[model samples]
Target: MNIVLTVLEVTAPVFLLAAVGFIWVKMGFEYRVQFVTRLAMTLSVPCLIFVSLMQTDIAPQALTALSLASIAAYVLVTVLCFVLVLLAKLDRRTYLAPLIMGNTGNLGLPLALFAFGDVGLGYAVVVFAVMAIYSFTFGVWMVSGGGSVIKVVKEPMVGATVLGAIFLWQGWETPRFLTNTLDLIGQIAIPIMLITLGVAVARLHPGRLGRAVWLSVIKAGICAAAAWGVGIWFELDQIALAVLVLQVSTPVAVTSYLLAEKYGADADAVAGLVVISTLLSIITIPVLLIFLM
Candidate 1:
């Protein structure tokens, strides 16, 4: 009973903030999604990642273990999803990327912080970084048939991740004032991301929702199972294991839809995956938290 309350306590704010965005959009408010997304990705999210990694108390060794575990888990998910897409006779360009990439940033980060505190956020950052890079490069390539390594290199988040990892390894810290400023900026990332998620979903026009529903179910299962198996094999500690599973099992990201729209690969279908997967996460996330907790 207490666990149920705890799970709800952790998740309510996330969905509620998202609901705020949804309602705002429904009420016809001015919410500039492109500007908001750019701000979060280019500035706030990188700060969050760097600060979290810099201030984390988790051992460097444990973080490295989790990083490798994350890469392995994603690899497994990709293979499984590829097979699923092929067998289902779905358009690879439209379905595969959404199946592989999850909303680790908006939903997963907040859930980790609420569920397991600072340590969990730190661990979640590592997984998010891995997924972000992979999504930027390989995931993009899958959809567009051509990904630029230079584009990946230019991403602010990737730069932040590399710098943060270096700092963590070297046990370095910035000046206190700078740290506080970055922390303040980083604080906005969670709420901004959550609200932005709602806005994006509200604004999207999804198609093939029936197909998306079943695919979302399959994605959640595959991601959670893959992460769980890899986490155990890698002997990640309790928090690390939980965070990995949660991050990897998050709903399909809105970015996947954006990428599809940009690259002209069934944007409506990808949007369906994003919306349905996100809605499905409301139930799936709490259930996983209950088990993980």
Candidate 2:
């Protein structure tokens, strides 16, 4: 009961407020939600990355662990995508991105901060940075059927990661004023992401719920299992391993749908997968915490 309450306390407010915002959209305030999401993606999120990386202490060992974990995650997801395609007899384009790109940014980051605090958040940032690069580069390649790799390299998020990496590598100490400014912007990221998720959910089709549910279960289960087994074998620290497993268990990222829509890869299916995985995460995440924490 205490665990349940804790989980609800941490998770519910964000989603509930978003739900209210969704209802407001039903009453004709949709633009507000869009504006917030755009602000977060374009401004707040980059600041969050800059602030977090600039402040966190990055030892060589920690960097090594994070690098290994990131590679593990990428390899696991790639193999899973292949198996899923073969086993489910899915077309290459249908489930590729949605299957590989879990929701590591919006949902995973917040949950890592909540569960493991600063250390978890730092580790998540490392993982997220690597995953972001892979998703933008290799993911686009796969989805675009070997289209211009140069175009993928030029994505704004790719540039953001590169900029953040330079800051991290230099071990730049952000001035107090700058850190404070970035922190203020960073604080808006979580709420904006949640509200965006809620608004997206509000547009979901009830008729597609069954398929969404199945995809969510598969995504959460397989991802968690892969993370757990690999993490244990790799001897990752408790908190790092926990963060990795929880991140992997998250639903398909919202970006999956965007990419699918852009690349013509079953956008509806990707959207449904995102919604389903996110909703089901309310259950899977807590259970995962029980094991990981």
Candidate 3:
């Protein structure tokens, strides 16, 4: 009973902020998604990652372990999701990336912070960094069949991750004033991201929702199982293990739909996956937190 309340306390705010965005959109409010997303990714999120890594108390060894485990988990998930897409006779370009890349940023980061505090956020950032690098490079290549290494290099989030890792390893810190400033900017990331998620979902016109529902269920299962197995294999600590599982098992990201639309894949089909998976996460995430907590 206590655990249930704890989980609710952690999760309620996330969904509620998202609901705010959804409601705002429904009420015909002006929310510029492209501008907001660009601000978050280019500025706010990078500050968050940098400051989190610089201030984190988690040992470098533990973070390294989590990073490796995250990579292994994604690899396993990719293989399994690939097989699922092939066997289901789905379009690989439309279905594959969404299945492999979950919403590790907007949902996963905040959940980690709420559930496990700073240490959890530290661990979650490592996993997010791993996923982001993979998604920008390999995941993009899977969709566009083109050079994606440059995209990864060009991403501010990637630069921040690398810089943060360097600071963590070197025991470096920015000036206290600068640190506080970055922290202030970073604070807006979670709420803004959550609200943007709701706005994105509310605006998406999902097609083939029946197929989406089943695929989302399967994706949730595969991601959780894969992360669990890899965490155990890598011998991650309790918090790290839990964070990895949660991050890896988040709903399909809205970015997946954007990528599909950009690359001329089945945008509507990917939109279905995004909306259904995100809606399904409301149930799945709370259940997951109950176990993790």
Candidate 4:
């Protein structure tokens, strides 16, 4: 009962608010979505990263464990997807990004924080940092058609991660007032992101949902299996292992849509995957917690 309630409490507001945004967009308030997305991507997200990093005290051992676990999970998922593509005879362009990139930053971070509090949030930060790097570089190369490597170097997330790392390494602390202000700003990110997602869903045509659902199920199932097996092999703690599993089991990231749009990799299909996978995670995540937690 507690777990179910927690899930409802955490997700219901975001989903409902996003649904409202969707209805508004359907009623022709498209401009509002643009404003929300811009706010989320620029001000709220960066502040969230800075504030989260600054507030967390990440020990060297924790950092090392997180890095190793994250990299291992990433590599395992990548290889699993590659094999799936070959065996399933999937279109290389369509499956590449969505299969490998889970919703680590937006959905996973918030969920981890909700489940395990500050320590989980710290672990999530490390995971997000690594995932962001992979998404920008290798992810772009996979989805984009002959784009220059320079595009990856110029990503805002990359810069934000770098700046956050520098602050962490320097052991810099924000003034309490500024920290509070950033916290307030950062708190807006999750809800806004969910609402923007709802708007994005409103924009999605029903015709594209079938293939997306199929791809999402495959991605989620395979990734979950890989995460579980790896967690056992590594002897990870319950909380850490559960976090990794939940992160991996998340839907194909929204970034997959952006990548598909920019690089000509079946954008509609990718968008469908993102939406379907995310919705399905409402089921898959709790199921994971039932055992892992």
Candidate 5:
């Protein structure tokens, strides 16, 4: 019973903030998605990642274990999701990325923060950074038939991850004023991400919802199973293990839909995934949290 309440407490703000964005769009408000996304990803999210990694108290050995573990986890997930897509006889380009890449940015960050506090957020960011690197590089190449190294290197988030990792490894710190400035910028990342999630969902036009429903269920199950097995195999600590499971099992990200749309690969199908997977998370996340907490 207490676990249930704790799960609700941890999970509610994530959904509620997104609900606000959803409602805002429904009430005919104008939200500039591209602008907001650019702001968050370029400025706020980078600062958040850099500062979080630089300041995290997690031991270097543990952090190193997690970094490697996260890479292995995603690689395994990609194989599992790829096989699932093939068996389902779906279009590989459209289905594979969504299946493998979850909403670690928008939903995963806040959930980690709320469920396990700052330390969880630190671990969550590591996983998120690993996923982001894979998503921007390999995920894009899979979807677009070609991805550029130059383009991937130019991404602010990618730069931040590399810089932050360096700082963390070297025990370096920015000047006090600079660190505080970055911290303030980083704080806005969570709320903006959550709200953007809701807005994206509200505005999505989903198709093939019947297929989406079943596929979403399958995704949740496969992701949870895979992440759990991987975390155990890695022998991560309690918080790190929980964060791994939680981040890996998040719903399909809205970015998947945008990528599909941009690449001309059945945007509606991806939108169905974003909608269905996210709705499914409302149930799956709370249940997962109940167990994790």
Candidate 6:
């Protein structure tokens, strides 16, 4: 009973903020998604990652282990999702990326902070960075039928991750004033992301919801199972392991739908995935937190 309350306490704000965005959009408010997304991803999120990594007390070795573990977990998820997509006879271009990637940035980060505190956020950022790079490069290519490594290199988050890792490695800190400024900017990231998620969902027109439902269930199972197995194999500690599983198993990201729309690969189908998987996470996330906690 205590655990249930704790889980709800942690999750309620995250989902509620998203709901606020949803309601706002439905009510016909002006919410600029492109601006907000760019601000969060390019500026706020990178600041959050940099500050968290710089401030984390997790041992350097542990951070390294978590990074490797995250890479392994994603690789495993890719393989499993690929096989599942093939078996289900889903269009590889549309279905494959959504199945493999997740809403790690928006949902996973905040959940980690609330569930496991600062240490979990530190670990969560690593997984987010890995996923960002992978998604920008290979995942984009998969959807558009072409990808560029240079695009990955130019991403702000990538630079932030690399810089953060270096700072962590060297046990370095910026000036206190500068650090505080970055922290302040970083603070808005979670709420912005959550609200943005709600807005996107509110705006999306889902297609093939029946298929989306079943596939979402399958995605939850396979993602959790694969991430768990990989975490155990890598021998990550409790927080790292749990963070990896939660991040990997998050709902299909809205970005996947946008990509499909841009690349001409069944946008409505991807929207179905985004909506259904996110709805499914409302239940699945709390269940996982109960266990993780």
**Residue pairs with clashing backbones, model 1:** none
Sort the predicted structures by lDDT, highest score first: 1, 6, 3, 5, 4, 2
Which numbered prediction scores highest in lDDT against the true structure?
1
Candidate 5 matches the true fold with a TM-score of 0.98
Q: Which stretches of candidate 6 lie over 4 Å from their true place?
A: none
Give the Cα lDDT of each candidate. 0.95, 0.74, 0.94, 0.75, 0.92, 0.95
Q: What's each prediction's clash count?
A: 0, 0, 0, 0, 0, 0
> Per-residue lDDT for 62-145 in model 4, tens only?
566767887898899999899988887878887877889888866777778777777777667777778777887778778765
TM-score of each: 0.99, 0.88, 0.99, 0.87, 0.98, 0.99
C-alpha lDDT of candidate 3 relative to the true structure: 0.94
On lDDT, the stronger of 2 and 5 is 5
Q: Which stretches of candidate 2 lie over 4 Å from their true place?
A: 32-35, 58-60, 147-171, 205-208
- Candidate 6's displacement at residue 146, Å, is 1.4
Task: Give one digit per residue, the lDDT tens place, for model 2 in 1-293.
Answer: 87777776666675675586568667767455557766876788777776776666756476567668767876886898688778877767768777778878777788888777777877777777777777777787778876555755664545665666677777766788878987898888877776677776677543356766876788777788888887787888888888888777777887777778888877877777877777777788877877776
Error of 6 at 123 (Å): 0.4
| lDDT comparing candidate 2 with the true structure | 0.74
In model 5, what lDDT does residue 195 have? 96
lDDT of 5 by residue, 1-293 (tens): 88898999998899999999999999999999999999999999999999998998888788888989899889888998899988989999899999999999999999999999888988999999888888888989889998677877898988998898889889999999999999999999999999999999999999999999999999999888888888899899999999999999999999999999999898998999999999989999999987887
Residue 67 alpha-carbon offset, candidate 1, angstroms = 0.6
Candidate 2 has a TM-score of: 0.88
Off by more than 4 A, model 3: none
TM-score of 4: 0.87
**Which portions of model 1 show Cα errors greater than 4 Å?**
none
After superposing candidate 5, which stretches have Cα over 4 Å from the reference?
Answer: none
